[model samples]
Target: MWLEIGRQHLSLWRNIEIVMVNAMIPWGNHLLLPLGTLREPFSALKRADVVIVHHADMASKLEIQAIESMVHKYNESVPIFFSILAPSHFIRVGNISYTCPLKDISHAILLCVSAIGSADSFVQRIHKMGPMHVDRLDFSDHHSFQPKDIDIIRKRLHKLESDFSAVPMMVVTEKDYFRRPEVLEHLGYEVLVLCSSLQILPLKGCNEESFKKCLRQHLEIYNLA
Candidate 1:
C-alpha cells in the first residue's frame, strides 16, 4: 500500500508465484488512500521504498513523478517500477480455481466492476478483459454497507438483465467484496469474485522483466560497494 508495488516485484518477492495485494478503496477502515494515493500534502510516498507506476490515470503519473522527486533529495537513484495490469480475474471455486484473462470468461453473466482504490486504473484494465457486459458499481473505499446502496446495485442489475439475455450475476474484486456485508450473506454462493495480482515493473517499456532485472542488478552493484 505504501509503495503501490507491481507484479514483477510481487512475483519476484513471491518467487514467480501469484501474489495479489488487497486494493480496496480507503485501504483500511478509514482514509480513502491512507498510503496508496498519498492524499496528504507530501507525507508518505516520499518515504516509499518502491513506487509502482501502474495506474493509467494521469494523476498516477503525476504522483509517481512527485513522489520520486521528493524522495530523490534523500536517495537520488531510487528504483521505480512501471507496470501494466492485465484485466484478469482470479476465480475461487471452492479453492480449486485459478486466474484467467477477462476475455476468456464465457460463462460469466455479469461483469460486476468497482474499485474504491484507483477506479480509473481498474477501468482501463477492465477494458482489456473482454466484451462481457458489465454492471459496474463503485463505492468509496472502506465504505460502510448501506441497504440503499445495495438496492441501487440491484436495480442496475435488473436493468442490465432486461437488456441482456441472461439474468446477470455479480463479479467483483476480493478487495471490494470484503467491504460489503451483503456479499458475505448473499454473494458468497451467487457472486463470482475475480482475484488479481500486482505487476509493478516496465509496462511502460513493455519489458517489465528486463526492467526489473536491470533494477535488481543495479541495486546489487550499488550495494556491493
Candidate 2:
C-alpha cells in the first residue's frame, strides 16, 4: 500500500525520481529483539539502501567494528553511515524564549529530566558540557510529566542544594520542553532545554569533502534519471 502511494505520487510529480528509506539503528550489543531496543530483526536491515548508526561517538572502536560486521553480514553493499547526536544549544523556558551555549552551563550542577529512548546518552551529552554534576530523572519514552513528577523534581532540586551547597539548574530535552512548557515554567525554578542534532561521522578512509560528495552523488543520480 505504501509503495502504491509512492508510485501514485511519483506519477503526479515528475520530479519524484528516487525514494530512499532509512533505518535508525542505535549502538547496542543487540541489533535484534529480546534484549535491546531494536524492534525489528537485524535481517530487516537488508531492505534498507542506507543504514544510519546513531550515537556513533558513544560506541567504542571495537563496538563500531562489531556493529559494522553485523551489518555487512546481512547487507554487504549497502552504504552504512555513522552519526552522533550533539547538543546544539539550550533553550530557556520563560516568558521570552532564549537560547544559550553549552559553555554557559559549565561548572553548573544540573538536574537532567528526560523521557527519551536513550536517557543515558542524553545525560552523557549533558556531562560533556563540563557541568559539575548531573542528577538524572529518567522516564519511559514519550512519558508525559505529571504533577507528582514535578514534585519529585522539586525535592531533588532541594536535595541538590542541601548536598552540594550550590544552586542547580534544571535541564530537559527540547521535546519535553515543547510538550509541557507551561508546566516546567511554573515549577518555581529556571529551566534550560537542551536541543540536539545529528552529525555524520567520516568513514575510516573518507574525508569530509569525499563523504559529502558521496552523499551528493546519491541525489545527483536522480537528476540524471
Candidate 3:
C-alpha cells in the first residue's frame, strides 16, 4: 500500500523498490502470540524479508538456535541477523555527572528501576554486567513516575538491602531518567543510568559487514535516485 501510494503520488520518481521489509523480534522464548509476549504469530515472519533478533548475546546458544529455527521455518530465504544491545557506559544522574564503565558497578547490589516494555531484558542486561545482585521494580511502559512511585522504589530498595544484608545502589534506564530527572535526583541515593547500543553478532553466514551491506543496498536505491 505504501509503495502504491508512493508511486501514485510521485510517479516522476524512478527506481523505488521495497528492498526489504525488516522485522525486529526481541530474543524471547515463549508461547507464540496470544498466550505470551509475542506481538504476532511465528507465521507472520513470512512477510519479513529480514529478521533481527535483538539481545542475542544474552540468550543461551540453545535459545538463539530455537529462535533462528522458528524464523527459518516461516521464511527460510530471509536473512536473520543476531544482535546484542551492549552496554557502553553508565552516566550518573545529577547536576555534576560523570561516566563510568559497566564493570565499575561489579559486586554491587542494584535496585533496577524501569518502565520499559522490555523490563526483563533490562534486568538480564544489568545482571550480565556482573553486578552482585539485581532486584527490579517494573512499571508500565512509559510510566511517568509520581511521588508515590518514588516511595515504592525506596521501599523496595530498603527491602532488598535488609533481605540481602547489602547496601544496594540505584540504577535506572536512560528513558526513566529523562522522563523524571528531578524525581530521581531528589531521591536520597545516587542513581546510575545505563546506555546501550546495538552490536551485530558475527555468525558463520552473517556478520557485521554483511548486515551493513544489506542495509546499504536497500537505502542505496534512494540515494541513487
Candidate 1 lDDT over residue span 127-220, tens digit each: 4555466557777756665666667777777777778866776666667766663543443234555666655544445366765676576567
Q: What is the TM-score of each candidate against the true structure?
A: 0.57, 0.79, 0.76
User: Best candidate per lDDT, number?
Assistant: 3
lDDT, residue 34, model 2 = 51
Which residue pairs show collisions in model 3?
Answer: none
The TM-score that candidate 3 achieves is: 0.76
lDDT of 2 at 152: 93
Instruction: Name model 3 segments beyond 4 Å from true.
Output: 1-36, 41-43, 161-166, 221-225
Whole-model Cα lDDT of every candidate shown, in order = 0.51, 0.71, 0.72
Model 3 misses residue 208 by how many Å?
1.7
Residue pairs with colliding backbones in model 2 are none
lDDT by residue (85-173, candidate 3, tens digit) is: 67899999895268988898899999999998678878977888898888888898789999999999888888878989987889988
Which number leads on TM-score?
2
Q: What's the best-to-worst order under lDDT?
A: 3, 2, 1
